[model samples]
Target: MKQYTLLLAEDEPFLGKVVKESLEKKGYAVMLAPDGKQAWQLYTSFEFDMCILDVMMPYKDGFTLAAQIRQANPKIPLMFLTAKADIRDVTQGYASGGNDYLKKPFSLDELFLRVAELLKRASPENQPADEFTIGSYSFSPKRQELKDSDGTIVKLSHKESQLLVLLLQNKNLVMDRKATLLKLWGDDNFFNTRNMDVYITRLRKKLHKDPAIEIVNIRGFGYKLIC
Candidate 1:
């Protein structure tokens, strides 16, 4: 059986432990981060199928982290856990790139259901492409590698590879900022937005060798990959 990777960001120690254990019991690989900042770091460093973020945290907030994640990989599923149940808070959560929001003091059953639903929704849409040609760059999504005509191989981080795949899957379409944030980082906030900028810069640098490959910023919208 294939195990899905889940990143859980929560500051409360006891709750984090319980959540991790529960998910692990279900055969999911769970990585727990004590704070939003650490969560963002873990997310960028590894590949996670879905993210569950706690709205409030130290150093960086969940929303901010989610925004950053969106900028890097726009097609991942994002869910939020929070105590605030006000309409404004829910709306804000959605605005910040949350696909689903769960209020605090909830049951373990609810959590499990939500996680399962997200994982199901995030499952890859179609069969993975064996090879992709973008300008002078050749990409193998399965291997997460990009090679140039000169035989120079550029390895991509998990998030980088995932982002590229999403862009290629939706080629010629404008992937909106909110959609990307919700999918990747699991939330959209100020800090996450900054993090996204960094990833975008890194991606641009990696593709700089190919003039025909352009990742364009559409101002108030999202990004467009032109090949």
Candidate 2:
């Protein structure tokens, strides 16, 4: 079985064809779907290492499709490829179980980088120490879930999982914002920065159950996960 199979659902024919070719050239076997309904059908028929979906489609939207995908397989990495840049759009995408977001008109290189990063993190060979204990919360990276002191399990999206892992890796030190953005989003642009802010807020809200875990803001620097 191929290790990096992908399912890409984009409504735009030109973009879809171009992206499909690009991914295939980069050695990812891709299954391209023109709409969310067919995308869901393909998803049900085959297993993909990751999914790239457009936020808008003919039959079903990306958010709805992602929700269905999440119900089926919570750990499969998913990315939203669309033109929507509004804060609410980003929030909805993450809430809908997206692991990453790439604004439309994106370069193929950037797309490749994002997909590769998500796959790398999801790949078993790249996973190290599946579970980590932090401040009364036990985190399972492979499962993208956190269990709190009260026994409530909080499911984390891909970006959230990666962000938390990076924070845990850095512990009490300040995580560099620019470096982190570059690694994950391929750029530290204004829009991406805003998206990061939203994700940070979500993470804080989720971790609020445990007072010991604080994602401290270091003015001008980045954030520090005080564990």
Candidate 3:
């Protein structure tokens, strides 16, 4: 079994302590933050396999923190722990890059289940291969790097690497748009759709070094990577 590290950001002292201890006992390395600001600090200072965040907190909010984290590491799994029941709040959580949402007064057993599922989905072992070859380029999704034919290495964000891997898998075939959004962003909402478009543009620029390689927009469908 692989060891996982989690970042828990909840302002409530009792809740934070209880969750931390409970997760630690489950064999995870847990780092608890009393506020969103501290959570951001911890996120920058350390690497975490996943983040469990409370929507309401002092100095900053979980949604804001989540956006920051997503920008820094787009592939990391994030879950929201919130008391807000509004449908808009739930929508906002997904828009801000949360992979899961758990309401307050929830059971520890439920939390454990969600955590396990999210980690499993994002686990590297689930990938078919650590590296993939594109036209005139070698891509290592695990390392988030793309090596050009001339040996110039380009660093990629977690999101970019994930997208590249999916494109590779469906090379020359149209990868379904809704399915891609759901798999990467955990939602098929308009916001995630637009976000995926942005990532697609980023990938195009990154892979443009190889004239033989092209990522084509399927127009009302998905994308196809041509090599």
Candidate with the greatest TM-score versus the true structure: 2
* TM-score of each candidate structure, all chains considered together: 0.56, 0.70, 0.58
Span of ten consecutive residues with least summed lDDT in model 1: 179-188
Candidate 2 residues 161-193, lDDT tens each?
888888888899999998788656645889878
Tens digit of lDDT per residue, candidate 1, span 1-227? 78999999999999999999998998999999999989988998999999999999999998888888877888787888889877677667767777788778889897887788677766765645799988899998778898998999999886788678777877788878776765565546766577677787888898899888888899998888898
lDDT of 3 by residue, 82-111 (tens): 998676898799889999888888899979
RMSD after CA superposition, every candidate: 10.6, 5.4, 7.1
The per-model lDDT (C-alpha) reads 0.83, 0.88, 0.90
Better of 2 and 3 by lDDT: 3
Judge candidate 1 against the unseen true structure and give its global Cα lDDT, from 0 to 1: 0.83
| Clashing residue pairs found in predicted model 2 | none
